[model samples]
Target: MSAELTRLAERVADLERRLSATTRTARLAYSSIEDGAIEVYDNDGTLRGSIGVQPDGTVGMVAVNAPPPPAPAPALVDSALAGLDVSWDGQWANDEDTTPLDLALVQVHMTALADEELSEETMVAALVPGGGRTGVATGTYEPMWIILVAVNTSGVAGPPSAPVQGQARRAASDDILNGAITDLQLAEAAVTEAALAAAAVGKTAIQDGAISTPHMVANSIQGDRIAVGTLDGDRITARSITGSQVIAQSLTANELAANSVTALQLAAGIVDATHIKAGSLTAGLLAADAINGKVITGSRLQTAATGRRVVVDPERAEVSIYSGIAEEMQPGGLHADVLDLGASKQAGVSLSAPSLGKGTAYLAMQSPNTTGGAGSIRLEPSDRITEPGYTYLLARQGNSTTQELIESYASAPSGGKITVQQQTSAGFTWRTGTTSATLRDGVLSVPNIAVGTARVTPVADKPTSFRVAKRLEGKEVRAFVTASTTVPGTVVEVAATDADNTGFTLWVTRTNATATNVWWLMIGSDA
Candidate 1:
């Protein structure tokens, strides 16, 4: 029984050894299903072995001994660049720190590699599981990297990694020079004037008929490119050029085709008096209502010269004075200047015609005549009589320089006693017998008077006693009476008094005398 138990114990011990070995292998093969990674750990839970498909889709494995004691922070040795992302590997792992460092120093240096020279350095967070397979940093385009360094939790610094060199992709112009592109390869119309070098694509460079309208870009041709007179009438389509397309004031009369410029072709209000040739427009050339008020400034037709007749209507024609019709006619013809009085007469003296007729006319001045009717100045013919030595009835002085005699009148100074009409070389002249009077403003003034005694002859027969009466329209009148002869024992008196606005009464008395002779005088106005 003892021997059988010993054998049993030995077999049990052997199985136990086998189980221990299998357990060791199983621990090495233990994997994370998500990442297909096999990991081996020591009894102290430290990483010892790892086998996995890496992030790059490549198989990799690592075997490590029990880690050495915490050493200085590891260093980066080499780096590779893919676009902006940088990858690096180095002796960065240490047993003293979990991962690279719970608080690690990961620094990246960025620099513009070409075209521009710029550099900046910054600290970045350490990537997970940082060490050999670490994502370093992302940098600007065309960037050239600097060495990467790290510090562990112990504040120990690592050596710098090798710099990663990079360059930007080639530009299109560079591509063309490298035989990567050809003329046929360019998109249609891709080449532009701005893109060409100075003096490039000259006439010699272009093949004949190679650059037609389809090949040329719109609005690319300049005025200097076109030769003078190259574009004839047939070359241009009608109305093809708009007003905006033509430079202002660029066209002259010679440049336009014959009969090509019409009203429709012209911009509104572009043609003014300055553009029109004198006498080019006439009444016969005008269409009915072709010219509107806005187009024609009526003032342009106004002639400043006076005395020009303007036919304003079918019924009448008027004399124009500085673009306006004359308002009145004086002895010197129509007046150019007029003053408005606002419903009142404003002239020093104004004369108006009675009515419109051949005989009807206005005179600025009239000369009074004692023998006949008044004579006046005429404006239609602008006529005046010139009597060099003879006295004229009326005279008008203008501007102290010129004087005109309106008329010559025949005057009979005394009361009318019809005499034989005779023509004398001195013309008609009369003298009053011992009496002279001056008339002004319908009033008569007698400076001196004389009385003569003659048989007291009465011009008209009267009953017993009669006094001569005179009519006066005024407030009052003064009379002066003188006896022709003063005889002894005889008295005479004369008095004058106001009557009803039309006349005055004169009383003549004589006592102890059968007859008396008297000369009477009166002064008053005729209203």
Candidate 2:
């Protein structure tokens, strides 16, 4: 079996060698070729079939048969829709000569079955050219519902017309007689003014009261045109006589009845001052609140009497009593002799000034004689004997306008703490003799000597020193020293040293070692 297998393997090798030689020398033809294209031809070399990229770059195959021709463009039909009439030949018979330029085609959609209910899915569409007509294919006399849609060249369709019924037939103008179209047959406003000849409508043509105001042009009727007594109150419409219709100054008092020209009859702002007679309008003629918010100018209230005219200036919100005529009053503000506010317990006056400034309330007293007494502002309690606490009068100091002297009375009994204070940075002064004594910063200074007492302890038989509280300007300080306890034979001495404007120093001398407590009296010139 091994030998037989070897023989078979040798035969296979021999067959492969023969096939390799044949493949090298012989050519193999393929029934179909792939790279982009393949063409089949007869012996005449005419192309019969091909599978290749077409001229449009799409891969396709073609046989001897050609593709079907594309569908023809839809035909156009001219017909009138429902509620519209067309000629017998199905042409639009409208008076207009122009047609839509963009109307390229019309699609005629009709119900498919004779009695079938019409819907979009059940209807069959037949396209036609715009304004062209075609006959229906129905044999029976039954009506077929149809709808027409206008299509442009871009295949865009406009809204469909109303569905039409029955065949496409309409009565022509030639079929109707001359007077057959009556008013009932014509649509509303069919015959306009332009359709009638000039002066064609005479008095007999219009019925009585048929020609209303709207039928006549504005201001067309004149007095001369109307017969006398032809137009009376019943003939004229209410408010029909406008301002332009009435001649200027023609309507006098006799022309209108009394109280006839009321507010309702007159236009707003038409009755100006020129139309109104002076002094003709009385208080009874005006409404109660007619002048509630109205402005009255000062010129309207001028008077000849002096000190009797009161001028109220609305702009300044001020009322001034004038002592003379209107021309004598000041132009800007109130110029009056006096402004007297009548006695009222609740009414109090207030005056304000700018910041960092003082407001002054002046009182000028008329003295009977130059010697003494004058009218003064007396401040007293309303119900009690004493005035209220902190109730004081403020007055500017002599020759200094900014400095004020205040004398405040306490709220206590008669002997209470009444104090006098002054608003000054330079302190207060008390003038008695030829010189004045100034008290500043809790320190009392005098032109003469100031005396005070102090206690000091001195070292035994040693000279000791201490400071004095009183600030003295002069160095002339005289001091006396004595032992605080009763010492029989103790000698002590006190002397002032280092005297300056602020303070002074006092020195003490004691002879006995047992004596320490020393009392001293200092007298110094403070000024």
Candidate 3:
């Protein structure tokens, strides 16, 4: 029996070892479940916890019991409760004559104490209700303990409630009531453009005619906002549309009414060349003195009808006129006003009028009247055929005054010749080099004459002569014997005679036969 018991024990031990090894292998093969929840159950088979997806599709651990979570603290009420009221009697009144005192009017004083400790010095007094989570008006935002006490009608204070700790904060959106805020409650500039939502302000929000020039910002009312046919002449104030208000190039002929714009309505210098349409302005459209003081700037002022133009070139500082004459007319044509040209120094005025060989080109200065005063002085081309390139100056000093004529002719490749004549008694004077010659009252007086010396061989006791290089007709000839090679102290005398235009004779009288030098002078008029 002992041997059998021993064998049986060994078998039991072997079975135990095998069972242990099988359990470990099963654990290693199935370490975790592929799907399904990992649930924990209590001894009674009640699910205590789970690590799996909940019904709301969230994967998290769930505590099924959670020990019934300690009873929750009382929630704060978001409203004020009614205050307790006490019945009171006036001073010296009987018991029947009692009055009910409203505790709300009795002023419940609330004090907010500092978080560190509660003291009188740290308490801020504010009037508030006691019950139903009433708030204490506190200036500070720090966490603090608030205590409240009710005052009786007799001004006696009641016992204070237990202090509650809280923090002062801004009222949330839920604390505000609908339509509680009004215009009077809003701060200045509190409602800005960004504060309004898109399309928040509708047409009904604005009153009729409430917006004025002061209220609307500049250029705020765009064209898209204005309804068609809404803005018209009657809607706009007179003279209110200034140049700055109008868009550039926006106003066309169709946009303007006839006679709508006038000088008074236009600003000074606002109308420029770009503003005016071509051929839009005419002589009749302008006032007679419209441009009197105004400056007209352009390249030229031209007449379309006559092809006359006056060009002013500012870069060159020059002015030129074409196909026209410039005349300054005075009232009644009797004023002695002078036409001034080239007022600046070194300035020149050129008057050129070519005849193209069809007529004469002359410069004439005439009197104002044809019948009186000094008549005219005319300088014109000479009419003499022999000197086609000659010019003459004729001065007619009226009917009572003498007329003077001066003629100038040029000989090709040589020099020029000038002739002067007086038609009356009055003559003129001419200066050449250091000598001056005057012709007056039909008499010519020359300060210097042509005097020359010539040697002549005289026949024995006879006259001898030589031809004068210059014509001596209509002249006085004077001859004198300067020296003689004849016998010394032989008494020689010279006489000028037979003086014609071409030649002259000089007679030498000497007692001996010898040559004599005679000096002769001739004074006459050049005709």
Best by lDDT: 3
Question: Tens-digit lDDT track for model 2 on 80-154?
Answer: 322112212222323342334444555565653434443333334443443444454332233455565554543
**Which of the predicted structures, 1 or 2, would earn the higher lDDT when compared with the native?**
2
Native-referenced Cα lDDT, model 2? 0.49
Q: Is candidate 2 or candidate 3 better by lDDT?
A: 3
How does each model score on lDDT?
Answer: 0.44, 0.49, 0.50
Across 1-527, the per-residue lDDT of candidate 3 in tens digits comes to: 99999999999999999999887785647566333346566776445566765545677666552221111112231222211111111121123422234333222222344324433333344343222333434333444454444443333444343444555555577678899999999998899989999999888999999878878887888889999999999989877778778888999879999998888889777899898999998899988997799776655443343435554555444444454333321101111222322111121222223233333344455552422334445555533435546544555543332234454546444535454544345777664333446778777766534555555666766665554444443444443335534356654567776654554566777675665656677655443
Q: Over 4 Å off in model 1, which ranges? A: 1-177, 184-190, 194-199, 202-232, 240-527
Q: Count the backbone clashes (under 3 Å) in each candidate.
A: 0, 9, 0
Worst 10 residues of 1 by lDDT: 414-423
Model 2, stretches more than 4 Å misplaced? 1-124, 127-181, 185-191, 229-242, 253-259, 267-527
Candidate 2: residue 49 Cα off by (Å)? 29
Evaluated at residue 510, the lDDT of candidate 3 is 66
Question: How big is the positional error of residue 254 in model 1, measured in Å on the Cα after superposition?
Answer: 12
Question: What is the C-alpha lDDT profile of model 1 across 1-527, one tens digit per residue?
Answer: 99999999999999999999887786637655444446566786444555785434667765544332232233332433423344444333353444442325455544434222222223333432244334443322344544455544434545444454543332345334677668979997798778999987788988887876666665678888999999888987777566656788898788989998787887765687988999998999987876665444333243333554332221212232222335434311232222333222222223333232223233454332322222344332212233222222343322111222233343243222221111232232222443334444444444332222112322223322333344443444555555565574444454545533333344445564355555656555443
lDDT value, residue 302 of candidate 3: 37
